[model samples]
Target: MKDFNLSYGHWDLYHKALKDEQRHDEKVQEAIKNNLAHLLSEESIIMTNGEGMARLPVRSMDEYKLRYGSNDSSQVGQGDGSSAVGDTIGKLPAQSQGKGEGAGDQPGVNYYEANVSLDDIEAHLFKDLELPFLEKKENGNEGEVEEFIYRDIRKSGVMGNLDKKRTLFSAMKRNTIKGTPGIYPITRDDLRFKTWEDVRKPESRAVVFALMDTSGSMGAFEKYIARSFFFWMKRFLETKYASVKIIYIAHHTQARVCDEEEFFSKGESGGTICSSVYEKALEMIEESYSPKLYNLYPVHFSDGDNLSSDNNKCVELVKKLTALSTLFSYGEINPYYRQSTLMKVYEQIKNEKNRFFIFKDKQDIYPALKHFFSVKEKATS
Candidate 1:
């Protein structure tokens, strides 16, 4: 069997195409329209250009398909068609059929896998859209090329306008008059065109703050799990978003912000109050990050060894933290003890899935990290 793998960008394009195929179904189309009315013309806000042209980003999968998918049988679409070809188009002979060899009591592999081309995907998303290609020159000036061009009729006069009928005759006469003029003819700067640039949107930035306890009770094994969890989270977050802010906080009796070196390297022996860790995180956000714009995520690790009286105050601080964050997640790595008072407080959160989490041992770290990012809450929807 052949193994297949695709990059993140490739997966994005694949899903975009899958979405296009599903849009053609009427039931799917209606459901999409009802749910995504904000993406439609009537419900969406239209931003107008300086030339008074109202523009909206392409949001309809069906519309994108018609303009750029397999159904688009235009000249431009045909230019970049798929290369996959089977010379024998008709049915195969019975002997040549390897169906029964692999078949059991159930039916065998009857479905044929159609290889879709990348051109087909690109066509569906970029059809009728003006794509600008920029080439930087040695002198620092940029040269531009447009995939499509149109000449203005009024400015070019009736004879030299974009009309196919009159343009040829006007061009012949104009070239003859200029080409023979005292060996000094027209320069290359005579062309006048109105070109628009393709607007590119900026990638969204997200920050994931990992706060871990280095208290003596955390143990070496628990620390290993916590560090491994942070590494995995960093890799996964980097793949998903363009920029990721990884803030590490190590707390023993007290908490302080630390860099990547001190995060997994330092060890301590003291009491724990989880609230101090959160307080530092809150301060970091207030000083630099804006809750409204940034995708704030906080993941904390501890052995649930915090003081009993601070549990209620810790819960209150978490509630305050949620208002200033996109999501708040807690990972309690209780190594020796069966359960702790701090774990009980976190487990009782109103939105337990979104704002809180609990883990018992080192084995739970991987699953806990996965669960933290995988929470699809009603608020996020």
Candidate 2:
């Protein structure tokens, strides 16, 4: 054993195996992409305690095993035992199905669980979505503010704005020009600093009004679907716009402004007054979020179980709101409440199909969201 000659072939094989494993993992993610709607649903989220990390059940690779082929058709116990067609040869213990306790040595079908973030789930859900009619409006001086933009570099500035690299380069150049070999002297002029210009930048701000009907008729399933839609909608808005203000309004018999937690979780028992919520949202918009200053989005979620009397009022309010809003989206979340009075009212007022959506189940959340945010290309004359 004087000298041991080791080849680097094992290293290449190891890296190749790692690449293959990564590819397999990517494929698994791609497979799970289609199931994002289910993953982002209320049921899946409730299982994870509303946490960001959700354990998603994924299909595992099929396990293969090499077996020896037998020449004889029947080998009874490797000897002389024959079994009937309906007779049980052996009994195998039942395996646990779900997230249960205890572990066993029994071999069974393998499954993979992927831990994915809510953001990732949203990204998948809203991958094809975009805010429509996001045209920049020239709102007077109210929208135009003096913003400090770093556009110019100067020889003089405050200590905080010193361009150290540029200053150093200037000092080095001056030193080189003066033929100073020993000392690297920095002159007053050589002290270059970054300068900022007070430019009047027009800021495009967006205000999202998330209205939900928390009436008595809205059961757990109804509330859950509404919450899921709002949650994803808020997340999608934040991702798309830099300056976005989200206002949550929850209504039962009466409409009231509430925080996100209260908006989604509060269980209010009363009659459904759909117009009240729209009125409150409109009032808020008129008072604070002006259409000229902000890109308004009035997104309402309901079970389509509003009072028959309130339908006309709701329609009128929606028309008024749509006049000011950049985009108005109304989502009806009841499967049984099909062709409902509230929906019928909305249909009459809706300018386009994408403006109004009917979500029957959790699977419809993604498509509804896409429909809400999608900008339809105007047909050329």
Candidate 3:
């Protein structure tokens, strides 16, 4: 009899290649996160109905590879009959340098485009944002719906719920009883299927208020930007809440409730009175959605075209809304560098409960979302 032990020295060296690959993947993810502000508003990404890949420009890590020098002896290259290995084949065309110089003195940046699917981008972007401030309050109208949960096994059931493990065991038992000791011939009595019990579960309740400025001052571009913000926010919210109730509100000189179709496409021509929408949102919150029953999120988007007379009223109403909300956000879509009467007033209230953003162009859309829904803590719960 003999007892022995084996050992493999320096076994960790074999895993170096895998470690390098993991590091490269981490770098790619970091680059995507850094460039997400611009990538979020890109037309290609926004228009990808539900499936597609997004090409993101990321700087490649400087990799060192062994190669021969330009004047090395080992050379075998053919192009224009005067080229050798590691030498320029011909005059390389100038890259974006407008035909002025023979060649730029500075070195080129090492950038490579990485193709990531929509799901990947979503995973990266949303990982940093969360809905932690959502607190479960008392007096909930939490309705329960019937759901089928598989639990038991039965002989007579649908094919979709057939239990293979149980059926095989039954077949084996029948075979042993018949003195065959095999499970080849499975009978009707040996077949087993899974059964489900109907039960009720409580669903989450939340309300989202999407307010937009439809005044004459808000052109097609401003409205489009607002719509884009809501579109992504809605998708993000749907994943968090089970029953999400969205209240679409469009306001010019007055505020009115409308359907989803009219909320994004409807256009109005009138003066700007931003306080009207704020007041209307506050009224709706009190009349229907109680803060104790539903988590409240009222997001408002305008061009900062609020009238001077209504700025005072807007600030007062905003203070009240922020107090009764799970997450409150206000966005100002100002394309041109114009003076904003409302933005100036709203910035003074340094209440950390509410979030405010000013977007000049499409590139600012994603950043605005990150700012509005960004949680201070690390955990989403």
Candidate 4:
């Protein structure tokens, strides 16, 4: 007779597998973060309008598992040797498509796409972004955000909102007052319940004017890139602000205030006049969105092909806008890196509040967003 001993290492196996999975997830997260710009520029995400899933393609790192009789030659694609020359014989793995002898050397397409919700994407993105300069508004809606706070302790309220700790303290104090100080039994009168009140948290009320040039020079690529920036900007504003408003202005040689749909979709074959949009923005501000009550943000996107005569007017309007606006910015979509006449003219306008950005490709959209909206840190003394 032979003697044998057996032991089970189930926990060790489980631990190793768990660690591998965790590492893989961390790797995927890093990849997603690195490629966030590309992901943000995807047409699917930009057009989603904050609904549905945003699929992310991430590479898998787990080792393939094998099962008993799985992919068995006897049961899979194998026949009784009576097959025709041209007959189909099932499919082959992508990595196994080559007919070269010996082991294959080419890399396999091992990546898989994970569905991430729009809210998740927004959370990952908006957590790091905020308006450049947000000022407190004192006009309507005293503060920008309303928060419900539970601080007041009442004698009569719902049982679910009972403040047990406060009630215990009350009971102890009452017992102490009654000369039976130590750990006395609680009474109905000692019961305390938490009450809440709506608090208006102080924050800035902002109105953003999204101005875009819809000239023929603003081709499909330029339009898409511009829209991508505005898409994220709109989402960011909605996610972070409760009372903030965004006005859309689209212009070619002429400027017009239209609905969001017309702003993004309308195109015209005409000259480019960058100043018209700025004038429209100022008009809108004077008409409804007051600079006193609203921290104005006027952001313009164009191909920088404005008429030479209008350049000075654009600069003057921008200066006027900067006087009232918190932060005024310009984004030029110059794919060819050509020195736009308007860009050259904009460079002459010297003001801390006036900032201009140039993006040649879609990937630049994320960095542009960060640059335009990143929260500025206070100076340390």
TM-score of each: 0.47, 0.67, 0.68, 0.69
The digit string of per-residue lDDT tens for model 4 on 225-249 reads 9988998899899888887889999
- Whichever of 1 and 3 has more TM-score, that candidate is 3
Please list all clashing residue pairs in model 4, or write none if there are none. Answer: none
Off by over 4 Å in 1: 1-200, 352-355, 375-381
Give RMSD (Å) of candidate 1 vs. truth. 18.9
Candidate 2 vs candidate 3, lDDT winner: 3
Summarize candidate 3's per-residue lDDT along 185-233 as a digit string, tens digits. Answer: 9889988999999998776577889999999998878887888787777
lDDT of each: 0.56, 0.74, 0.77, 0.81
Error of 3 at 44 (Å): 3.5
Q: In the order shown, what is each candidate's alpha-carbon RMSD?
A: 18.9, 11.4, 11.2, 13.6
Deviation of model 4 at 199, angstroms:
2.8
Candidate achieving the largest TM-score: 4
Candidate 2 segments whose C-alpha is farther than 4 A from its true place = 1-17, 42-50, 61-110, 140-203, 379-381
- Assess the local accuracy of residue 319 in candidate 4 as a C-alpha lDDT between 0 and 100: 91
List ranges where model 4 is wrong by over 4 Å.
1-25, 52-54, 63-110, 137-142, 149-197, 377-381
lDDT score for residue 340 of model 1? 84
Comparing candidate 2 with candidate 4, which one achieves the higher TM-score? 4
Lowest-scoring 10 consecutive residues by lDDT in candidate 4?
A: 7-16
**Number of clashes recorded per candidate:** 2, 0, 0, 0
